[model samples]
Target chain A: MSRNLFDMVWDMHKVATLSTGQDQLFIGLHLVHEVTSPQAFAMLAERGLKVLYPGRTFATVDHIVPTDDRSRPFSDPLAEEMLGAIERNVRAHGIEFFGLDSGNQGIVHIIGPELGLTQPGMTIACGDSHTATHGAFGSIAFGIGTSQVRDVLATQTMALDRPKVRLVRLDGKLGTGVTAKDLILRIMAELGVDGGLGYAYEYGGAAIAALSMEERMTVCNMSVEGGARAGYINPDDTTVEYLRGLPYAPSGEGFEKAAAFWKSLASGPGSSYDDEVGIDASSIEPMVTWGINPGQGIGISGRLPRLEDLEGAERDLAAKAYEHMKFTPGDPVKGRKVDVAFIGSCTNGRISDLRAAAAVAKGRKVARGVRALVVPGSKRVAAQARAEGLDLIFLEAGFEFREAGCSMCLAMNPDKLLGDEVSASSSNRNFIGRQGSPTGRTLLMSPAMVAAAAVSGEVVDVRDFV
Target chain B: MTITPIRSLAAGRGIPIRENDIDTDRIIPARYMKGITFEGLGEFAFHDARFDEAGNPKAHPFDDPRFKGGSILVVNRNFGCGSSREHAPQALEKFGIRAIVGESFAEIFAGNCTVMGLPAVSASGPDVAALQDLIEAKPETEIRVDLEAMRVGAGNLDFGISMKDSYRNALVSGTWDSTAALLSNLDAIRAVASALPYIGGFA
Candidate 1:
């Protein structure tokens, strides 16, 4: 019988069927970061336990790391303590540490793929919601909690109930100025934020097949926003080629063997799915979120939905969004004043994302009064951007080219929105207070759109500026 | 490190919040995540929703004197919608809530609650709405959640709720303490880790 990619990978990782009826799945890779792991490590200490499979785990600092300055003794005492705790915990447990000085240091999701650590047919777990980012490589990745983090560290296995598989196929060619970011925003809008509940979204079809490895990562990264436990694109030539020469990837003949195995993991022609949805890529335009949730989105040229346009609970949510975001119903998103323009996150902070934004920023200066920032997802992405002088292009455009970290994505660091400042952000999660302020508003858009907003100081259509 | 099993719960009052899709960010705003521990999270539970910009008290359900010590929370569909922050469940648990009955729950949030020994049971939309209405009308009514029978009782209303068999067995059998179970299977885990080339390469 043919099986989907999710079932194939999940079957490979199933360690045991517990008496509780959940599978004891062995995690092939466990990624940890500063913010969530400190308490987990402490939990292990309290239990007098050591990392049973330290070799399977890796640690890095990202969430609370200050993007502007990396000097020792961070301004925030809590941030400093969290970082210090992770450093000690990793060292004591004999796990690999991607410290601040390490060139490998970056967001856990970004570093894993760039280093060839994320591979097809593996189960990866991280103490972050965006761990779904690794599913781009055809692996089954999950964002777990601190206690589950401890479970993985101590046993390299996590108990989980298997999820049904949902096939989200996007066909046809994407129009110019449309990107993976817009495609995902469109998916979330069409399928409500909770649409993918109890399912693993398997992304396929012509449009998804055409996206680069980086673009595939961006699409998978936001699977959590759609409420999918995980999302993935099948491993094909694009995936194999992207992984070929990375540091941890197999070499030469070994690479050939690995590629062949990865090819076999793709969903077979007759593979079945619990549910399926198809999207016409040609119909999707540059999308933007106007409400407090990622699902409340509209095309850049389209007007915000009136209260009457929405039904039931959504209507109530629309009213709350209107009051919080200060967006007028039925008004076009264009020309809405933006206090900040941020172009970075694990979702769209890869080299290609920066290049796309740089193309928009090359000949234009940021509009006065807009605080613009471009943060790379990883140190390697930062190094690559600087090598190509994308950093200079952004800086010359009056955008702050900052160090690699989560940065303004969740704004755990100092790069936060003040008061009720509205921002055009190329990050995921537009939930209330998500950008570090209670009343602060975030409008999610593509990186190029965020750049256009920086140049125009409002939510203008990127097509106009490009 | 075993978590005490939570087999059954009986609460004198249930706090009802009619809003749908109450995300984790609203339960405990991201700013409060700066701490190194889950301690003291109770005070900050619903900190933003319950307080104003100037730190004044707001008219939130949690703040009502009638529901001050409510151990059961009744909410609308898609409760705990975003973020895998266990802090949301941690806050609810810290705020003295032992169980949650909602129209539905985001998968991760419910999982987190299960591990923390906080049972999150789900009922049909009309059943949850009826429970909320009944609770609001009579705050002194007793709300009972029984894991063995898989039912919720409030006054004359008896609503059958659904829970994954695994989650229910874990809670009833005290096997929900995942840390202990994980630690017990160390050898098998090591064998699996050794078989993976990616992990073996590290060694």
Candidate 2:
């Protein structure tokens, strides 16, 4: 039977169908991290089930690892123990682990593509919501829970019902100053957080094609934020070129053959979709989340929406969002005073995002009492940023340049927000207490916008700073 | 798993908190969230934080002993927000919470509690207020949650809870297998898809 890329890939990875009608998808790649994998690996030990596909699994430590002061004993005893647990688990299982000593360690999502472990047409699973970040390489990647993590480790397969497909087409070009972060925020705002329920999104169209692999990673990383099961782009020269010269990518003639197969995974020209959404790229602006969920967003220049202006579930969410964000309806998101300004996370913490933020902070000083931090998405990115003197620019501008890890992004590490501090953040998710303090507030924006807010001590348009 | 809605009541201040969405981090904190059974987690609830730097519950409500004896916990929406760690609720249950009442709970939080037999009651508007009043008026007040009737009564206050019929039925019937239910209809789904006029290549 004729099939779309998604269908062909799904068939390629299927192990069996359960009585529940969900296909038992055989994971071609499994990624693990310190935070969620310890218990899963322990569970495997308890069950005495060796990993069926050890070669397919790769492990790293990111969350809870201190970005500054890399030493034997960690300040947070719990973080130290968690790291030790991961080390023990991986060692016991005889799996490849990219430890701090390896110099190859970073965020699980970041390291995947940087190391070329994420490849086109592969079914990837990880114990992280941002596992979808790997889908940028034209892979079918999704995050699995801890128990499901165990399933993948033990049998390398998971029982998941096939999601209906949603075709999202964004045509034309993004305006200047618009980035992938804005594109995704715009999509979430248009679709609402739950818009993609029970569906996998095939992101197509000229705008997606125009994005670099890093940019695509930023987009697919937030697929979960849009409630899509997963999101992906088609394999093209960009995908192949990005994978080439990477540490783990097949080399020589083997790579050439793989590239051909990868190119074949593109959706056929006439392929149909269950649900389709067409968006004009011009319609999307540099967007930011004004309220709790990612969907409660508008253009950076736009005003917060009145609750009544929404309909059905949207209205209810708007009301709740207002209550949680403690913001009056119809207020301007710009110029909102911020005590903290963060410009990092897997969402928008890539090297390019760092460059944008540094450019914004150039020759400018941070606002008094405003604490700003610049964390690279990976160790490699961190080294490169230092080589480019991006770190020096940030430091001179009064921002703390820390080593790489998922810092402040979740505060599982030492980096955290004090009570009730309102922060302008480049990281996604402005949910209640998401930044650590129960009453702490977070405003999600682009890295450059965060830099502007850090210097101004309030939300300022990055376009003006530029 | 079957989930029953329970009317959430309000009680605050000096109450021992069985905080909703108590993930392994908050309940046991990351330091002690690992290793042993959840048996000792109750005493360790907010171990690193119960008191605070000054040994007080300034912002954290975990140290409030007033809500300690209350079987029901009133909570904020999306009570379980971060992490898929089930140990959060495990510590709460170990701390002696039998049920949680909130505007809504996280999908993972509710699922974990279901497996552990901890009932999460979802309430709305007025019913939420009545529960609050009842709990505040009597610290040790116990509210019985009736999944079949979808109601909670404490003293003179009565509250109604709503959930999907399938979920309610599952709670009442002691079968909370949503996946099994979906699976049972696979043949029917196939039949319907085949019967559809234009759903080609779907199955």
Candidate 3:
């Protein structure tokens, strides 16, 4: 019998079934970042344990790094302290460190793929939720908490309960101005935020195959937002070609052998799935989240759902969103004024995202009184953006071309919102106070939509520019 | 590290959060998460909801005088949905939440809770709602969560609750730490890694 990529990879990595009825699975790649690793490292010290496989674990600084200044000491003492903790811990454990000086430093999710550390048919674990971003390469990658991080460090494995599989098949092709971001938002809206609780999503079909590697990453990156522990796309020419000649990828004859193995991991023709959800790709439009969660999104031409249209928990959440966002039910979201426009995160911070934003920002001035910021996902992304002069385009448009880091995505650094400023953001998670200020609001959209919002000083359709 | 067996949580006062989709950002804001450790995070649990910009107390259940010492948290569906921050569970645990009874929970959040020896159990929507109503009607109502029996009791009401069997087993067997159990299979882990093409560099 043929099996899907998830089952194949999961079975290959299963070390043992423990007495507790959980599988003790081996982790092929363990990615670590500053904010979540410090405590895990401390736990290791407290328990007198060392990293089981130092080489398999990679460390980077992202969440608390200051994108504005790469200076030695971050102005925020706590941020500097957190960075110091990771640096010391990595040094002690002999793990590879990607600091600002490494040129590979960016978000952990971005560097993992760009460096070829993320590959097909492997199990990847990270302390960050968006770690599912690695699944674009046909891997079973999921995020874990700090304790699990400690477990991965002390042992090369962690215990996990198996999740059933859901095949999210996207048919047809996306229309102009409709991107992977839009398609994913549409999927999340159709399936409630908690829709994927006990399942891993396998994205397939012609539409998924049509997406570029970066676009596929964007789709998988937000799987956690939909409550899926992990999401993945099967390996094909696009997946393997994206890994070609990368620093960490196998080379020459080894590459040939690895590519063949990866392709074989794809779901076979007769592969079975526990459930299947079909989506019409062409029907999706550029999406913008109207409420506190990513699932509370509507198309660019749509209006906020009236309270009466929603019922039960949905209605209660919508009422809370209206009260928090100061939005009127049935009011059109278009032309809603934005105080800030942010473009960057593991969700939409790839080089393609920057290029798309630059395409809209070129020769277009940001509206007066709008604070626009363009942050790359990684140092390499920033370098690539500079090579293509995307940075110049954004800078000329009155957007702050900042260094690579998480930046304003979660606002762990100095960059944050003031008062009740409304923002148009390309990052995932528009949860309440997600971008910093307790009262600040976030409207999640694609990078181009963010650029359009910045230029027009309000929520505008990106298709208008096209 | 010594492991502690957590069979059940005894009857205690309950805190009812009558909202849905209360994410990690709301449980503990991003600014407070910058610390290197999870220590002192209890004071910041539900910081934004329990306090205003000026730090004044808000009309939140966690802050109510009646539920001051509440050890069981009763919530609506999809609680702890965003950001796989362990700090969310850490904050709640430190804030004295020994068990959580909700209509449902986000996958990662529930797993994180399990690893920390905190049981995140689920019940039918009506059962959860009835429990919350009972707690609110009488703030002094005692709530108990029994992982061994797979049930939750509030005041005069007893209802069936559900959690992953693995989680329940780990809690009862005092192996919730998992690191010891996982490490015991180190040789098998190495054998599996050796068989993987990628791990061997496809050579």
Candidate 4:
């Protein structure tokens, strides 16, 4: 049988086809973070095993480490211990380590690409689920558990059955002021969170092509929330340009040779898909996740969906979302007050994201009583934003400018929403209690929209601010 | 990776954490949610609330070192939820939790335990409470989960669990490489590779 692009990619990466119908897909690159890796490496140590491919794996600290007080021996004893453990683990194992002290440390996903480590035509896995963000470079990237992490460490391979690939074609064009965050939110709302179960999403069509590399990353970063194991965009010139000269990228003559290979990873002309879902980009408006889960969303101009307006699983989920979010049925999601606004995460914290948010928050002052904070996705992004005076603009507007890390996105770090505070956030997912507060409500939106909300103290459309 | 379903565990008892959708985050808060080793995390299990105002180990009934050897953790539905943090299972395993019974578990959490040689079981509400009562009645009681029959049995209480056959086989073999095993037979693998004739052309 003629193999599909996914099949070809899977077959190309397979070290061995196991008996149970799952292939031991070679992981071209593996990223480990402070929180999940120390223990896995410890398991290896107990067994007196060494990392099979140290050059292929990289390590960094993000979770738990205090973004602000990053000095050694962190006040949180556990944080210090975790960081120390990874430091020792990487050093002893001969794997690359990006220490906070090394200036290369950042969220594993963000720094991977900026440092030119994450590349195209490769299979990547990390302990963190958002690792799919690497797919913007046309790589097949996904998250795995610790044992799987250990498996990848010991053999540079992961075991897996192939998932059905669904081509999500976004044709037409995005209307002005609509961003990639909105594009993903719209996709999630249409598909619901569980829509991609047992599948990988291949984002394509003009809308995705029209997006910048960073923008495409913003789209793929949320695939996990929609229940997909992985998501990717076919590599193109934009991807090649993004990889032209990163620290780890092939140099000079190697670059041209690599581009040709990377370009071949795209679906062939007239390639058929197991499933195809098309969307008119112009129809997707600025979107925000209204209730819990990425699927519970509404357009900027759309009304909050009523429990009755939903049906089946959606209705039940929506009712729960409403009761938890304390939202009224049929109300406009716009203008809902927000106590906090977070403008970072691997999802929407790239340098481009910071620039876009800063554009909206430049002259506008934050609303009284709104505690807005901007967290750069990585130290590199933070340094770039600072170079452009974006950090100053945010600080002048009353938003606390912070260092790089996942921050409030998952509340693994010190920066987290307190008590029952509802936040307007640029990060993905609004699951109940996901934002630190057991009852804290999260409303997800684009970076610019989050900035606008920070200034207005409510969920205001960024177009008006623009 | 290995998945060794419990041959049987001495029934364990403790005060219920009583959280529904007790995500992997709460199972082991994101801060302690690091490291590759499964050992020693049991002490830090539920560390956020396990410690009191002074960071001292609160005398929560379950925090007693006596329950440290407890084998079962009874939880609400949709338990072991949230992001695919494998450390959650590591923490549970480190704490000497031999088995976990919930109404449901997040796909990744359930799979993580299966790959880690641990048993994250699913059971009915009444059955879970009965196990809880046995623990509360005698905190040191050993609860045994019989993987051979897929059931958790204690004094006067027995509850069955359902699992995928692949996962069951993995526990027995101590290797979740069912995919690899299926091909272990030379003839079967030869048949599979031959069926997909185009595979050889790729290399």
Candidate 5:
């Protein structure tokens, strides 16, 4: 029987089927960070259980770590306590810790791939939602709750019901200035936020296959926003090349053997899908979210959705979004004022993402009254960007170049938007108050689009500036 | 380590929220997640929608006196549509909501609810609308969710609910406890881990 890549990897990882009928899937890697793991570790301790397979687990402090200052004893007591707890827990459990000073420390999703810890034909679990970022390597990665995290720590496995596979095929080439971020935003807008429920999205076709590894990561990173349990691009030469020399990757002839094994895991030509959706990459433009959710998006030049065109619950949601966003139906998304422009997150914080943003920020100055920031996804990403002088380019354009952390993404740290301040962000989620203030508004866009917003002081097409 | 089986929930008053796509953010805002524990989250559930800027009470459904002690929440399509935060279900579970019947639910949110022993069942859009109307018409009327029969009923109105067989069996047999399942398969898990080259080395 022909099977898609999702089923292939899932079947490979199946350890047992419990009497409850859930598959006991072995996790090849488990990533943890400060915010979610402390409670999980505490839960394990309450049960008097040690980490069953500490070798498969890795820890880092990202979510609550302050981007501006790296010194210990953070200003936020809760943040400090959470970091302390993870540090102690990882040390006691014999799990690898990528601490604040570990140069490898960054967002858990970013560090995993860059270190080659995320590999094809593997089942990776994390306590963070963006674990789908590792799916770029053709791994089956999904976010789990703290209790599930405890289960993984204590048994190196998790119980899950298999999800049906949906093929999201993107053919043709992306137009100039369009990015993987734009592609995903366009997909979410077309599919609606809840379209991928109960399905594992297998992203493929010419456009997806053409994307660079970092770009692929950006595309897979936002799969959760579209309600997919997981999303993956099948392993190919691009994936193999990206993993070749990473610190944790296999070396020399072992690399060749691993790559061959990975190649075999791709869906065969006769593979079938439960459902398939075709998208023309050329039809997409520089996309931006105008409303509260990631699905409430339009092309930079497109107008807001008309409420009259929608019906029932969708109409109500659009109305609520318009009221919350202060955007009028049929109005252009371009020229909307932005108070802040943020360029970073696990979504678009790679070296390539920084280079793209720097290209837009090189010659122009940020518009007066607009506060812009450039945060790297990982310490290694930060170092690479600095070596290439991307930091200087951003700094010269009046953007604050900060340390590596999940800054302002959830605003668990000090960096946050003031009340009702509208921001142009390159992060994944645009949920209400996601950027800090109770009513702060976030418009999700590409990193270059964020740079364009910084210079224009409003949402604008990145193609116009580039 | 066994979870208590929840085959059937007792009949109870149902609260109706006519809104669709009530995301996790609206359930419990991100700022409230800074705490180490989930304690006291019940007070802040729907904090923004339930209160005005000056901390005055608003006309949100959770704030209505009629639904103060409602144990069942009937909602519209795509309830809990954003974020994978378990806190959303935790807050709902703490806020006296024992069961949720909606037009649909986000997959992760539904999974989170199952883990918390709060059953989130789905029905058709018209059936959900009818359920909401029934609840609004008689807020004190008792509604029962029968997992065994895969139906929810209130008076003469009953709607068929759908859930995955695995999730249904887990909820009914108390095997929803993932910890217990993991422990039972520990030896198999170790064997799998030991076979992987990456896990064998690097420690």
Candidate 6:
């Protein structure tokens, strides 16, 4: 039997074998958001069910909260109503909520870790797909639908089939300017979009261990893009160190005990995985998604694949991408002019991401025609960036520094692309109209690359910034 | 806690969406999900993909008159690939998609369909391609998905389909609405939670 962290955590939470042959898994942490929770709450009310374990659930507003002008009764009535629903629901259920004035509010994935609520060996569930971002802390976290959210609320457990574990080991170290974003993009590219369909990815090896907690999050955040519902790294000293002194984490002796328990959950010698795949990290370059899906990516120095180079479904999707993006196959990816530049999302909106972007924007000005925006993932991240003067650097460079929210990533709020504008975005997902405009184009890259594109007015390599 | 058992889907007209990796955003754009409830989402299903900024109808299968009132959706590989938004499947369900036949589906999307009592079944690539072609060629052809028989039938053609056995069981047994089944084991859940070191702060 597989003895990895995923298997162990899964077994620990397995409540019973349901009639359908699925395991009834107890959810340790249930994160809720504005967009997907209201209907679930309504369903619970209709069923006359009360929240089974209110303390285990946490709520926040991100999907529809306006990153700019976040005053009451948001200019958008629907957005305001959605926010109100969450506020009322959390209050009624006694679930802790990090609202606008809470000073802890942010993207659900970002706040979960920053507040220390996301810990090792815990099974976390959220309605948003990016919930896999929590897996960086060695937790088993995955996204669920509204009905599953209702189940987690009414019963504190969900019926799920166990997914096999795929050990994705990355050897060597990433080169300068090649970030965790690039590492994950390359993994998605090699694995295709549905490669991890029924598997949970256990990311390990020297390169994974070398990544900081935020960097690891960036890697695990996009696990869903490669079709893995959950991805995680084994807890180590770095994991413990990052959790130390956080608001929700245990303190002093309790923390030491927690740390030992966390370390014990790591897959040890002779542990086996269902499958193993290894890649050399040093070979990966800064990646950019040229197509709608996250898998349609290439290294910064590479050119788009020609039609004749692909076959079957791959060829068909490439043909569609070329027509939709209006880019010729076999053309160089660099020097493509961009109209907007966005830096923020659950994927790359933390303090570290802002610092990396600021380092690039320090002595540069945004291109004359480009509109750039920097959105922190949470209020805490924004405060930390301001304290470090990263906001000043971005503002001086002509980038609009806005309040923390999902922002241009999903474009549920007012932040959106206009017309057929092309954007260099740090947010995950370049799906058609994902940036809020059906014709708008997005080039997925790291925060630094987004900064470089903002300054150069085109798709340029971040390595050139140095 | 009760749900309608979905043992098999009766013959119905199929809508062909022959494309690989059709993401959830394309099914229902994020803007339309701003509403508090999934009500009235059917009209907005595939909103951006079927209409231009000016609200002019685009050349989409959903807008094509031939596929009007289609209850089954025939698609290519990796359908519903991005974003775990239940709105995507809910939009399709509200738009009258009772069952989905595709080459493959994202795990979360398929799971969402199951809980909602909608069946998202899969077949071989060639089988799916042929089915899509058949649907496009004759939009009035009746298609039936039989979970008990593990096959899809239309005219004299029969294609073997597969789904997660657990999902099939849940649907066939009307246990797809799993909240009741999970809640029934509260004692076991409490026992498991108490034994876990993290739940009690590892003290």
Most accurate candidate by lDDT: 6
Q: Score the docking of each candidate (DockQ).
A: 0.57, 0.08, 0.89, 0.20, 0.55, 0.91
Query: Compared to the true structure, candidate 5 yields what TM-score?
Result: 0.97
* Residue-wise C-alpha lDDT for candidate 4, range A209-229, written one tens digit per residue: 999999999998888777676
Off by more than 4 A, model 4: A19-21, B1-23, B32-81, B91-107, B119-168, B177-203
Q: Report lDDT (Cα) of residue B18, candidate 2.
A: 26
> What local distance difference test score does each model get?
0.88, 0.73, 0.92, 0.77, 0.87, 0.93
Residue A124 in model 6: lDDT:
98
Tens digit of per-residue lDDT, candidate 4, span B33-120: 5443566677776665566435777665457666655567776555664577887787777776766776566556777887776766
Better of 2 and 3 by TM-score: 3
- Flag the better candidate by DockQ, 3 or 6: 6
lDDT by residue for model 6 (A1-466), tens: 4488988899999999999999999999999999999999999999899999999999998889988898898989999999999999999999999999899999999999999999999999999999999999999998999999999999999999999999999999999999999999999999989999999999999999999999999999999999999999999999999999999998989999999989989987577998999999999999999998999999999999999999978998999998889988998999889999999999999999999999999989999999999999999999999999999999999999999899999999999999999999999999999999999999999999999999999999999887
Q: Which residue pairs come into collision in candidate 5?
A: none
**Candidate 6 ranges beyond 4 A from true positions:** B1-3
Which residue pairs overlap in candidate 3's backbone?
Answer: none
Which of the predicted structures, 1 or 2, would earn the higher TM-score when compared with the native? Answer: 1
CA lDDT of A377 in candidate 6? 97
Per-residue CA lDDT of candidate 1, range A14-84, in tens? 77788899989899889999877887888888989888778778888888899998898998888888888
Q: Kindly report which residue pairs in candidate 1 clash with one another.
A: none
| Candidate 4 A-chain TM-score | 0.98
Give one digit per residue, the lDDT tens place, for model 6 in B1-203: 34365656646998999888899999999999988889899999999989999999999998899999889899988889889899999999999998999999999999999999899999998888788888888889999999889899976569899999999999888779888788888899899989988788877
CA deviation > 4 Å runs, candidate 3? B1-3
Chain B TM-score, candidate 2?
A: 0.67
Give the native contact fraction of candidate 5: 0.51
lDDT by residue for model 5 (A1-466), tens: 5988899788877889987787899999999887767778888888899998798899898888889977878888878878878888988999999999798999999999999999988899998778888999999999887778888998889888899899999999999999999999999998888898888899999999999999999999988888887999999999999999999988887888888888888987789999999999999999999888899898988888899998976788889888788888998999999999999999998999999999999989999999999999999999999999999999999999999898998887888999788999999988877887767889999999999999999888889876
Model 3 whole-model lDDT (C-alpha atoms): 0.92
TM-score of each: 0.98, 0.78, 0.99, 0.83, 0.97, 0.99
